[model samples]
Target: MLTANAAAALLDTEAEAADIRTYLATQERKTLLRFLTCGSVDDGKSTLIGRLLYDTKLIFEDQLSVLEQDSKKHGTTGGDIDLALLVDGLEAERQQGITIDVAYRFFSTPKRKFIVADTPGHEQYTRNMATGASTADLAVVLVDARQGVLEQTRRHSIIASLLGIRHIVLAVNKIDLVDFDQQAFERIIADYESFVSDLDFSSVVAIPISARHGDNVTSVSERTPWYAGPSLIGHLENVEIGAEDRARPFRFPVQYVNRPNLDFRGFAGTITSGSIAVGSEVMVAKSGRRTRVKRIVTYDGDLASASEGQAVTLLLEDEVEVSRGEMLVTPESRPNVADQFAANVVWFDEHPLLPGRMYLLRTETEEVSATVTHLKHRVNINNFAHEAAKSLDLNEVGVCNLSLQAPIVFDSFKENRSTGSFILIDRVTNATVGAGMILHPLRRAANIHWQAMDVTKASRAALKHQKPAVLWFTGLSGSGKSTIANLLEKKLHAAGRHTYILDGDNVRHGLNRDLGFTEEDRVENIRRVAEVARLMVDAGLIVLVSFISPFQAERRMARDLMGDGEFIEVFVDTPFEECARRDPKGLYARALKGELKNFTGVDSPYEIPENPDLHLRTLGRSLENMADELESWLRERGYC
Candidate 1:
């Protein structure tokens, strides 16, 4: 226990400390601008930020003293100012003289406050650049005056646009080395402006400066009399950023369910759009389930409501089936559910993206299998033209069609980040291979009645036959699979079992002839064929499909669309030697000529089925015996 005088003195100290904290919080809350400084290597990104802090006198005496001491210890010349020493203080960064990670610095000016994200300028660290730009409101893309605009410079510009940053300030650094020529600055300005004219940036400001000599940084300089713009820091303090209006669709992708104890259950995520209040009705996308918000919780405490730009936890009145991947949005402004969309893609892998291969797509918290439908065109960065192209290799930018396994709820990337952006993961290595933005959902204009008629085209003939409906066939290629399918179709016609052989080759001649043999393309071909087969099955006709449907994943996907008894798999178990001897199309010979790549049973691997509903040895057995065996199998299955 303290005496009366001692206790009173302790109370006084506590009050003073509390007063100081209140003042700081008030100052921080007044800040609204968040920007990042990014550019090529040694282009003065860190030095520029350091000069802003140092020139403003924001650095404390102790910190400045330590910087001066370190400068002398490291033997860095130039009046012991050592601006780079403040940011590039890490031992590894100092030794390598390159920024490796995103470094955040916060400081306040009299006019406005700022938070600068200094990102690495290297090409391979595009993922790191993305991480820093993920939360920035503006970006200051630096270009060395001597080097003009390099590949990484264009790449950073593209990324900034993709990340939905509103403002871009092109800082022409190291102007002193270029004699501060006004013509040089104009040339660069005109070139870059023309390049990014189509990009969706609200504002773009160009400034010429020398970060090393403090020219045009903190105040006006005599070096460039032709330049009449505000100083670097002056523009940053006055740059008009359009504030986010959260009056649009409410989107909350549940990142985590905060279950601290049995009594507490809250949904936590960073709000991407609109607002939510207590008792506000919201619907979970896809499921279309509706619920009311019980309470809006925050890190500080429970609140009456929450708005966009604020990360908070939500409590619902009912324990709905909400998960991390599912999106919570207002029903009034719900997004479209689409399985296919067009997207602008940036490919970053060594191998080119081919059609038919499967990649895992992660949009917000949701991950699904996706395939590139087709490469529309490659972007010519130098002139900004879309060249007709078939594929995109490493470090290439292009537009393409992306087909997802399931329909996803999303908005255009221009409208919302939380529901727009997604990452593509390679299925084999699980690496993030590409990044994409949804352009538009694909739409096919056809009436439901028309589709119903297409399903009934062959149903009348099948019912007239005394046999039970149709015959279903399946197997791999180069195994006399199609020949057997043709023979069986003829036999079924003669026996009066209404059947249609949807031979893979015959259908490809019309529906899928434009498709290729790439892994990505092959999957799409199968998906389209499977949909057609399901429609035929609905018409009460047996659809026989004989294609090299390699993967079990693809086969399972096809089987899911039809009823249990509607689809059947027939295995054509034939030796490679016999099939090669009877090679009808000379495809096996072409595989041996090195003319084909990714050929199953040649260069690429093939997966044989472990079990099938009907198995047949097509090569050695007589055609009559094979037909008899098929008739009995159909009889057992009630098809004949």
Candidate 2:
């Protein structure tokens, strides 16, 4: 080398050139695209992503060397570099040769920067797929040329549509395996278009490509002369994902109340949609109180205005009451505020979703107790048909009526994704069991309100000599529950106690006539009957409910509806064999012959009470004796 000064100058020049190159690269990646690749297992989704990364020169030299070595050692491409190995980073995935979790990759080209989500293909991981699609602006659904359209493909398409993904690309992968047949590609395209006609998508383009051979991915392939469409990478780079959110109304859900000092108080949250200025008039959705925005506080001092995707704190001119879970929106265009709404839900729990069970409904920054009041129908992914469904199992999509404990602000999922999506969490386990998109708020919820009356339940109960109570009888079918309840009601009636008996079969003829013997229907049947009994108890009556409430959870629900010490669970304990032998109405015989489906003691399950207030061994005890025991207990409790 020459002198040390000359060498230093040369090094500085190289450094400046590198910095200039980096700045130009960053400037080139001005536009950002978030998309997801989804398809069935072995559909070459990861391979397509790998091909994009490799062909664009995004892979490092040393990483490529290691990949070449790994391909020689354990590649599935028969000694060629397995492109899937580039993205399947999990050990379990590499061992099983299947993607289990969503693998995210970031890469940029001359036109735009891309964040690609490679979602799993297994049906069990449908929740993971939903999570990935929830934030994606476009979806690239891959299909194997040999298999054409499959059930998993339809399922993913349905989910993508439900998630409001407007742009879709049907990548007919592995075209070379079929000798670059244009007819096969056309057939697949026709099948897909015909099936997807019902879905709501802005545009759907079908492109034939070979991800393994890097044909028609980043560059036009010479093999596919019939395919006039742009390559996959070219389409992704140029597709205009519209900025529709800018035109939508503003919505900001307050996540935290920021009180840095006594003088400074602000509501902090991310702007979900539209834009907000410092002097904009905002309304608290829940309270409907109007106020003016005073300041927009951020980490970089303060902002005069905040737009969608910006997280900032807002200070209001008026000291209006605000809390977490409250939403700030333009008063002129407020979202719907209601407790009852209809939503499309994807059930992800192993246990099927039954109506009337309480779950934690969590949205952006709010959580409320909610119940799936009714399941409208389940969507069949294979044919896009709606079928009657009482409950939703794992990986099933259904439209349901939800009842929330409190009103929340929301928009139709089609209008805004941030304010319209929510997840159901299991109350006991705190596990996410379902994902739902709000369709619309039910009109009845807003129209009807609980009218306050001078004559309350307490006043009605005080009018009667005894306290209002619900004596619920539960056991297997033909377990003498009805007979024992009738005798107890008569005994209480003779003792001048205001008692009314709500027998299961008698009430089924009128109130619960629409219900069937299915587990979901049974749960609803119990719910309706319990509400009626609660109303009767509020009318100052000692209600005796006799039903074969087989499920312990349902009995607990009824118990929870009553006041403390007001519900007395009477377990009519009779063995299944004993109940079947004593089937007076021939129900057990019909159920055994498969004529009566979902008949308890034959096919359906009956959960026994772990701890009942009164346990009567009906095998050895008479109905009159059991009634006397209940009457004695009531007398001791001063209810008679």
Judged by lDDT, which candidate is best? 2
lDDT of each: 0.77, 0.91
Model 1 residue runs over 4 Å out of place are: 1-12, 39-113, 120-124, 219-222, 246-249, 255-268, 279-292, 298-300, 311-332, 337-340, 354-358, 371-375, 401-405, 445-511, 516-640
lDDT of 2 by residue, 538-624 (tens): 898999999998887678778877889889999999888998899989999999999999998778888888889999998777889
For candidate 2, what is the total of clashing residue pairs?
0
Model 1 local distance difference test score: 0.77
- All candidates: CA RMSD in angstroms? 6.5, 3.9
Every model's TM-score: 0.72, 0.88
What value does the lDDT take at residue 516 in candidate 1?
76
Q: Which of the numbered candidates is closest to the native, going by highest TM-score?
A: 2
What TM-score would candidate 1 get against the native?
0.72
Tens digits of lDDT, candidate 1, 153-181: 88788778877898999999999999999
